[model samples]
Target chain A: MNILVLLRMVPDVVEELEIAPDGRTLDTEYLRMIVNESDDHALEQALILKERKGGKVTVLALDAPDVDDVLFSAVAKGADRVMKIEGGDGGVTTRAAAGMFAEIIRNEKDLQPFDIVLTGVQAIDDLDALVAPILSHRLGLPYLAIVTKVTPDATGKSVTAIREFAGGVRGEFDVPLPAVLGIQAAEKPPRYVPVAKVRAAMKTSKIESIGVPTMADGGQPLLDVSHMRKPVVSGHAQMLDGEPEDVSKKLAGIFTERGLL
Target chain B: MSGNIWIVAEQWRGKLSEITFESLALGREVADGLGVKLQAVLLGHDVQNLSTSLGMADSVIYVDHTELADPGASAQASALAQLVRQQKPRTVIVPLTNVSLGTGTLLGEQVGAPVVNFCKDLRAADGHIVADCVLYGGKIEATVTPRGDLTVIGLWPGSRPPDKGRSDRNPPVETQTVTFADQPSVKLRSYIEPDASDVDITQQDVLVAVGRGIQSQENVALAEELAASLGGAVCGSRPVIDQGWLPLSRQVGKSGLNVKPKLYLALGISGAPEHLEGMKDAPLIVAVNSDPDAPIFNVAHYGVVADAMDMIPTLKETVLALRG
Candidate 1:
């Protein structure tokens, strides 16, 4: 019942993102990184499974500026072990990352016993949603995505997952052990780890690092942004200017013209 | 290995999903750019009638099997992989839904083709294909080129209008069969369909949709008041519902209800593709957010770079004054 959780650090979306001088990538000078929201949920789901089934939880993340803090936080939240894969400046494509992950899992002799591997269904930074599927494919395991719930069978041979489909439809699946899933959300919101506990975990735990030579040797990402510009808003929406009251009045005036009033 | 472009049409319960038609539209462009035929591969039991619907393609390849009537990822991937290996298409496109992601991924792995999901744009450039993909919830876009000889792509739904097949003649049809081993790795247990909600927000003329920017459940009342003043219904994005501030029935997104109102007032909604897909077709979109770079502004006709907290109250007052 051992579980492996793939965590990712993404640039915080709330902060203003600026294009670098290169014009194709984000300006990393003042960029802040945090755990990808869905990956946080995946880690939470893994911790919940461990708490219920008495299994070890191992968290894996690509090395990024704040990744050690994220791994330590996972440990504070009940992850048994955490490892940071070295390489990737947070710009690695999902396909290439999956290749490195598959390579690591295959070559790391001590890490081969995980019964299930889970990752965020999609990352805010990449939005490719291909890593789990590609990883599972490379490892020859069954793959499922948008999973909201996972339950182990009493016999411990299979796990049942509830997958969320478009339009609120939910499908329950019985996937065999040694499967991979793209978790959409945990059953509960990720539990909060107090700063004290995270500090203690930082002092007590050490993060193992795995060196990755090149994510591109076998699975190079073919896409690169040639240029980026602010998306021009379509539909020609009329922007209301001025103070809040004045803009609100203008909006009401337009609504009245439409006779909605 | 081959120049032809192929699209794996997704079907559920004997009917082709709209996404299948959309993929064809996208594939048509890629195929024309490559000066190749756009072909469709349909796999299902007794799906002969469905092949005719793919008039957008030059031809159709049908793989029939009983197990495919209720196909899982393994079965679908196995069948598609065999066909793809034999046909050796230059590129294969499938819808990036919860179901077909596995098919695309597994087939790519089996054939040593790299897979990229949620492609927003595709082009044939200098004898190679390139795709524009979004990251950071559409905040950043990256261009990706597949390295392998073969590429499998996952097309995002609503990327383009579904192609209307030719009314004059049906596309040529070719049938292929695949022998798939039993996929015992995953089994379908049950389906938990959501109950029909009492209120159908899709019928409303106006919808005030709130997101995480609304801050707290207490602030939701302000949005409700604004919605009430405008004589519209109040809906929310996934976060609000997840926080128990709104009912699941009132949630609007790919995983929630789809609404196409005359006016969609998005408050604090970051306009993730999920939420945008549900309401992008609305006639008029007005978005209010504190972040100027929020993706919602890209689609909104009218946007105010202000907090929903300040705007909602003033909006309500103005609406009430108009009513008076």
Candidate 2:
């Protein structure tokens, strides 16, 4: 079972993001980049599958800020190898990234066809959530999204997957082996790697670098943002005044006026 | 064939989802802007009656197949791909749901068309579609132009109201038959639904939703007491449910039930986009949290910057006294 996990670095969601002067994208200055939360889980999922099924687990990510740290961390957490593809300014569309990744997966001399590819169901940065599907399409592989559980068949030619539906409903599927899956969650909480172990792996492990041939306008990004502005609060929120007690009293009065009492 | 806009009207088990109508509402606008006709594409085993409800479209197109009775993403995508190939509609708008996430992506890939997913807003600009997309958990918005002659879009639910497309005139329904290749690679085996709760939050007129700020399981009782006093139902966000303080049925968000109660008292709920998408339509929203900068304040009709734990009990007492 050869598993490939795609990871991405997104802005630390805790920090405030401001629109650039162009009013189109985020302001990069002072922004802290962190491994997207779900992508971390994707790595953990791949590692668990590798441990159980006895295969090599490779972590793939774009060459973005703090990406090397993420790759080294994956190595410390038991990934067999890590690769960083050159190019990507943190704003590349998912389709463009998928195109590049497809090329790398197919052309990398040391790599073989992976039996399973896992990615976070969605990324916080782009939120288009198109990467895994586009990659699957580019590779002519079966694709499944919002998957929570994956169990490889005894023959290893197929895997049974559990997909999540609305209202907490779940569906089971029998997906073929050579497939791309958008993971909704890992089998368990991501195991924590001590900081010292990660630091040690930084000296022992080397991240393979690969250059990707850019596609047309880098996949001719489907849409161009003409303009952007802060989302207006349409509810016309009325801020209640005074202390908590006074506000509670006022809320009670409003509820009484509306007969919600 | 090239300029018309199409909406893949989504239905399951003979019923149309709300996002289906919402897609039509937005599709109508796109069609008008592109100077083209709007069409609804319905796929199911026997959905002729449901197609009539999409009266806003200029025409309704449907494909009835037994395999579609419980359509998975691959089945729907294969069916829609055939439709797209036959009728080269410039744009196909699909509802942004977990199910459509794969269907829409594969359909676009099948036709070699560009796809823009999770669109909150769309407009035609210079013969192209410009979209406003929410990113980083709705903290930032990006405007994108899906640069292609053919675009497949996943319209976010709640972007437009379903009633906006309501009309007296029923569109003509057109039926088409296409051979569906067996989707052997993936097959749906079974569905597991959450256990039913005592109170159906969907039917409740008022909801008091608690979030992580509620702290412990005991703190949940405060919100319950408040809900009881105000004649409302008690619910919680995903965190509370994950902790077993509430059942899965009581969860409200993109993955849970969408509720539009008359009043929503959000306690300690920092409005993530997922949670807000479910209840933002509530007529009167009152939020209480210790952090004033919580996103819940943006959609709330009334807000108080205080700990929900400190205020819930007093608020319940105040409501009781006022009712008397």
Best TM-score goes to which candidate?
Answer: 1
Reference-based lDDT, residue A67, model 2: 90
* lDDT of each residue in B1-324, candidate 2, tens digit only: 567889988886678888888888888898899799999999889788897789999999988888787757667888888888888889888877865667787787788777777688888877777887766766666677776678888787878888997667888988999787653457778887777746889899889999989988998987898898888889988557646688768989866778999889999887877788889988889998787667788899899988888888888878888778
Task: Point out where model 1 deviates above 4 Å.
Answer: A87-90, A127-129, A213-219, A222-225, A232-236, B125-127, B163-168
Model 1 lDDT tens row, B113-213 = 77766677788988779987666776776677777678888777776687542324588999998996654467777878776855678889989999999
- In model 1, the Cα lDDT at residue B192 comes to 81
Pairs clashing within candidate 2: A222-B145, A222-B146, A222-B147, A223-B145, A223-B146, A224-B144, A224-B145, A225-B143
Superposed model 2: Cα runs more than 4 Å off = A127-129, A213-217, A241-261, B125-128, B168-170, B180-184, B197-199, B203-234, B238-247, B261-263, B289-294, B305-324
Candidate 1 pairs with clashing backbones: A124-B136, A222-B144, A222-B145, A223-B143, A223-B144, A223-B145, A224-B143, A237-B301
Please give the C-alpha DockQ score of model 2: 0.50
TM-score of 2: 0.87
Per candidate, chain B TM-score? 0.92, 0.88
Tens-digit lDDT string for candidate 2 (A1-261): 999999878887556667789887777897889987667878888888888899999988987788998899899999999999875555787777777777788777567867999988777665444678777867777788877778888999999888877776778888987988888767665677999999999999999887766564456565666666556655546889787679889998887677776
lDDT of 1 by residue, A181-220 (tens): 9888888778899999999999999999888745445555
